[model samples]
Target: MRSRRDDVDDAAAVERALRLGLVGMGEATDERAERRLDRFIAAPDGAFVWTRDGDGAAYVGRITGPWRRDEDGAAVDLVNVRDCDWVTEPVDPGLIPAAVAQTFARGGRNFQQTHPGDVEAQTQTLWLRLAS
Candidate 1:
């Protein structure tokens, strides 16, 4: 059995990871995925949440729209963008725009009601490939 010291060390490591700005998605199972999804929805000021991919590279994104439940599962407005600070030099996180979030909310509502499957709707989902 692991000692108390070992448990403390593990907790410290997880804290450091979160401070490094990457939230742990402990194993990519359906339960964890749903939990992470809830977290994205809970982020204050609509900041993007970063998570490690299968290859150990981190990706950043935010929920650009409201959550909707379909036959497959629940889907939300997803904007897969690079953390601007990581892409460039680090800067103050507070400088990020709150206005941009409104645009995302409007887009998501309009898309869901009017054009659920339009080809141009793909543009609504932004995907930026970050440089390693």
Candidate 2:
């Protein structure tokens, strides 16, 4: 969702823009959106991120830069972005953990943190294998 504020440098501005209904054609925003934006803005460099494309291609990457507003991304409805050093190849579907697969399958346009026990362990294992 595009924020009305050009300078969305912190979570508070993002929260305000969202609450005022000034983002993305007056789309409804909620606590989840606020939390997601907060995490996106606050995530440290080197944090891992997983995402799937519209074509169902999964990718794994590390955050290499800070978040910023990319006006160029407006056409794609992805104005807020972070630079990532994604693995060159898409991850094999069979290799993805069950929790990760479920996250993708749920199909919401919000960033979410995976559960902490099995999901985290499995993801770390997958990351090690991929990084090697």
Candidate 3:
């Protein structure tokens, strides 16, 4: 549940983000990340999709997927990093990745694969520390 956070300065931001860039965490020790990704895809149809970093704080909604509709309406390669979950409350409607959402929406694609995206997003992995 890696949190998406930023530092006081952009320099700090870049450093922080780059440090853990694709270090492969969460499921690092075990295949937890892979399993989590699998579980995310296995959720009920229409269920949203997101990834929590190893530290558990950094999460970005999988906006686009491996295949996405380009402006021309044709399937084209997309960055697949459009997470809009923060738009609303406990969870917003359309905040999840459009492609992932489509699977749930259409009840298709038994498995949703996680690709490489959002490397810089790891700058400040959010680790929400609840009060003791």
Candidate 4:
């Protein structure tokens, strides 16, 4: 799998996002999206998890925060955090803070994580960066 996939003018789109410091869901999964961008899909319960397998996604990534859908689109409340697969919804680029935006920009990572559900097409998954 590649790093990321952007069907549109990704270079330009990412550039714009960098200048503004934000991202969009559509842009989240386009080209090598699944490999690059991963998120935690919370269950109906209040609890949340990281690994897509052990808990959420087995051997996938970590879960960041809660899920909230609003004018900004689907979004997750990310606290003072770093290095983990965060929750996501449709989001407004402007709503995202610069620091969080920077985290997303950083690419090329892999970690010991789990995969959620079975081998499905759209299983709630999160991105993982392997540790050295």
Winner by lDDT: 2
How much lDDT does candidate 1 score? 0.30
Looking at model 4, residue 39 earns an lDDT score of 42
Q: Give the per-residue lDDT of model 2 (tens digit) for 19-130.
A: 3222221112677666677778787776777765445677676667776666644443455666666655678999888887887787645566776558767766777888
Identify the candidate with maximal TM-score.
2
The runs of at least 3 residues in candidate 3 whose Cα sits more than 4 Å from the true structure, single-residue gaps closed, are: 1-29, 48-86, 89-132
Q: Candidate 2 overall Cα lDDT vs. reference?
A: 0.59
Residue 121 lDDT (model 3): 33
Task: Give lDDT: candidate 1, residue 55.
Answer: 30
> Runs in model 2 with CA error above 4 Å?
1-32
Instruction: For each candidate in the order shown, give its overall lDDT on alpha carbons.
Output: 0.30, 0.59, 0.28, 0.29
TM per candidate comes to 0.25, 0.69, 0.22, 0.21
The window of 10 residues in a row where model 3 has the poorest summed lDDT is 123-132
Candidate 4 stretches greater than 4 Å from native:
1-7, 27-132
**TM-score rank order:** 2, 1, 3, 4
Candidate 2 lowest-lDDT run of ten = 19-28
Query: Residue 44 CA error for candidate 1 (Å)?
Result: 5.2
Stretches of model 1 off by over 4 angstroms after superposition = 1-40, 70-132
What lDDT tens digits, residue by residue, belong to model 4 across residues 15-128? 332233233223233445433334423222222222211111122223334433223321221111222333333223443334333434453222112233232212232221
